[model samples]
Target: MDYVDTFITVAEDCAAQTGVVPKPRGGRDTVAVLQHRMISAAPYRLTQGDVLFSTWLLQQGVDPATVPPEDPRRAEFFAVDRACLRASPLPKTHGWGLHFDAEGRVALVAVDDPRYADLHDSAGKVVKAMRSSRAR
Candidate 1:
């Protein structure tokens, strides 16, 4: 399987093992939302780096249960706020961040100053494209 499949498998396994519900927000399913409202209100966008990271997570077989509660990756997977973004501390080159809202809607944020133009690409569209590409 590809990296995205691997990550999704791990996340799904983690949810199944923990009995965590896959909450949907704005038709997107996620595990948790960051507490900060400002981050939650932002538009849903995704970057090429975000897609790469998701693929990497899948390939590594990362599981939420295996990730430490304090691990920044956990926050990257779950939280949607500036604090979480700061905490995650992604490389300067990796400017995009992802999170879920209170309603479990998945959203993306641009971390680097003077964000890239493509960062505004609709997350839902990106996700759909990713899924379609993966199916092939």
Candidate 2:
């Protein structure tokens, strides 16, 4: 679900005390790396849907140019329930927090950044990132 005026804090089980920039593994972008690239490159410019769709497109090796909004691919993709940013590894492992503005545009904030603290304390809604592992 898209969150408006919400701040998703780092997971309680996250080990990193500060935000760590995710790196490509095996010279290929993993989901976390792709998300980091997109969110960091354009803070608050893209909504949750935009980030999720773009990342999925890149991972599928589908050129976005070939799949216009009118294409059925997007509809087919979203037809099934997809996890939201709360499940994203950025906040769960990479020490980044996600802030959704009033318009639901998302931005990345480092866990240790003052802005994160401010958002955590002041956002209209606050939620923690989903834990990486199930609790024993």
Best by the TM-score measure: 2
- TM-scores, one per candidate: 0.19, 0.94
Q: Can you write out model 2's per-residue Cα lDDT over 1-112, one digit (the tens) per residue?
A: 6789999999989998999999989999899999999999898888998888888999999866477777787778789999999999999999999999999999999988
Cα RMSD to native, each candidate?
Answer: 15.5, 1.3
lDDT of 1 by residue, 1-136 (tens): 1112101111111212221222447863222322122224443332223333443354466642354446677447445432222222121112334433233333443433232234334222222111111232
Question: What is the clash count for each candidate, in the order shown?
Answer: 2, 0
Q: Identify the leading candidate in terms of lDDT.
A: 2
Model 2, TM vs. native: 0.94
Which 10 consecutive residues of model 2 have the lowest summed lDDT? Answer: 63-72
CA lDDT for candidate 1: 0.31
lDDT of 2 at 134: 92
For the record, the alpha-carbon RMSD of candidate 1 to the native fold, in angstroms, is 15.5
